[model samples]
Target: MSEIGIRTSGLSPYVALPAELESLENLGISEYQRAAKITDRMRPGIDIPILGLFGEVGSLLAALKKQTRDHPDREKYAASIKEELGDTLWYLANIASRTDQDLDVLAQRTVRSISDWDEVQPNFGTFDDIQSNIKELTQSEFEAILITLAGRVGDLVKDLGSGALTNNRDRLSGHLVDIFGNLLTAADAARISLGEAATANLLKVFSRWPLTEEYPPLIDDGMPDNEQIPRKFEILIEERKINGKIYVQQKLNGVIIGDRLTDNKREKDDFRFHDVFHMSYAVFLGWSPVLRNLLHLKRKSDPIIDENEDGARALLIEEGVSTFIFQRAIDRDFFKGQTQVDYDLLKSIRDFTRGFEVDRCALWQWEKAILEACRIFSELKRYRKGYIAADLISHTLEFRRVPEDRRED
Candidate 1:
């Protein structure tokens, strides 16, 4: 059958070849021979501690880092890094495959053994215990172990401290796989004991905590009668005030929307102005407390907002606008659809304002709204440059038109 026409019946369409076939075919005999030759070239200097390993692996790490950092051309650097990584992996696989081993099987076995070991031994207990274990391994045994590990899994370890230790990808890969394999096993056992202590403490707190009335009033006694209190405080006192006095002043503060004023219609205007002003004060005063409580609650509750909103919103808006423009350009065949936004670029916008504020949820909400607006504008193609410009001008005019009394409130 022709290669294009050949199709197996009753087999998974996706399962054409074993997943390992690519690695095997790519490296195969010729690549293995090349690696063996390289290994032999470095063998003469094997007795020299740093020279043997450094020449073989350290140079590769340094070159990779430099290619990644020094190049202004991102595409070039990315391609170089990818190619180097492939070469490194090919070399590793060749070493393993020729040495009568399967890298995947080795990885699985090592991980399982480490997991079991950790379960049986429990804790390392102290730093001294860890040191003693490290000291116990013989030099030849350590070298053999590292070599075996590197041949199976060297890509996991990160380089550290001036290319002395982790620069040897071959050796580091082996040592890391071994160390982590064992470490994970130990962690599993340790977590069980640690988890018990944590649960007990949580239960103790839950049992002793008191329940209180909801929507309690804020005390107005704290405010001076003649002195003009901030709008936020005033709103908080009005909204949270129960009976003749404020009972829940601290809980009521929030942000003021100075732009959201009512039309001058005596009763409606007075009510709207007072309500918004009081709410704003309440929101401001309660801001920190609410944020603090939200954080505490978040530890036990599901985190709805994971990052800051304002910055994220701006980034999202920027991204949406950029994406819209790019798509339009593409549709118009401006750049022949060559320009593409990468996954990283999109994620960068999404996570732009992470860790900026305490109430990440609030920020996320605002950002989400901005992103939505951008998406709508992009899809509709109604709000192009002209619309954006006009909106900005109108917003400015509206702000400037606000009366001084309303602005003060």
Candidate 2:
């Protein structure tokens, strides 16, 4: 990754973790402060984490906004809130660490501000009494607590802007204590678990970017070669204008596979070639139900694995996630020159793929797949025809221009 350059905090930034991993049931503030220290060691100061707090708080409020004012997808909304609260908590802990403040004490002195805040409180108790206790709150009650959270975040922002935070060590510490308290208040309003939030956040943050890089363990180690996504493969993806409409087709070895594809919209957006994204999933994540189906690589020898992991249902989910991210990328000019996908986009993709085999893959793996695919997708768009190759063992993708003689369809 260092060769081509992997994403970092500045750019937006791997690991294989156990399925039932990351339990922080009795996680203490001090311990959490340490765990949240995944920032780039090169950039020291309270700035990055403090700015991250602002963005996370905004996302938390946006989730609440959608839940309250829009037709919320209840499950997605809930996952989003859990993730946002956890992120808010991490930045708060990160702030504490950078400022040399005590999250333990900040948590203890949390003023207990909201009326029903106790009911919505997170799992992290006072440093001496780490525990999880929560009761649901009415929409109005959640609103009140979250509104208070906004104010506290505003105070922290003021501290950051005032320059007092950088110049006065004592003042920064005070601001951190207050911010940590409101972090609990935000968790309460969301009725999220702090221990769970912190743990989940650690899973996500550590997984998405690298402090120490760890490539994912392949999912097809013992599977039959024909049933497994090939360790190395190349496919010819070519575009042609037939009947005044552009279409894309793919070929492996000497045989064609799958029907030719188009954007299938009133507008031609080059989505016809989106299968490039799937090829990417196969290479980086070691999971793509669509590719399994297309290449006849489904694990039929294990009927249950075939039925569940490589079934129609999983294929649809993968397709849906591709479309979802494609639309998001469209908005940003397809992430032109960008190295990473944003947190919310990754979060939503994570929620969408929650039950599938791909769920085992980490966020960074997903980001890598998406970014690499988009890179090739961009190249494919520019040249109109290319040979996209992959070496699955190395988990790398390459796009090579087709020879001029071969470019003619």
Q: Model 1 over residues 39-124: C-alpha lDDT tens digits?
A: 23233321232223323344334544575467446555434333333333334334444443443433343435544633322211
TM-score winner among the candidates?
2
Clashes of each: 26, 2
> What TM-score does each of the candidates earn?
0.21, 0.80
**Candidate 2 lDDT tens digits, 42-154:** 26777777788888888888888988888587776777788888878877777777766656656755554546324333334433253334577788888887777777777
> Which TM-score value belongs to model 2?
0.80
Over all chains combined, what TM-score does candidate 1 have? Answer: 0.21
Best by lDDT: 2
Full-model lDDT for every candidate: 0.29, 0.75
Q: Which stretches of candidate 2 lie over 4 Å from their true place?
A: 1-26, 40-44, 70-78, 108-142, 159-167, 185-191, 241-246, 407-409
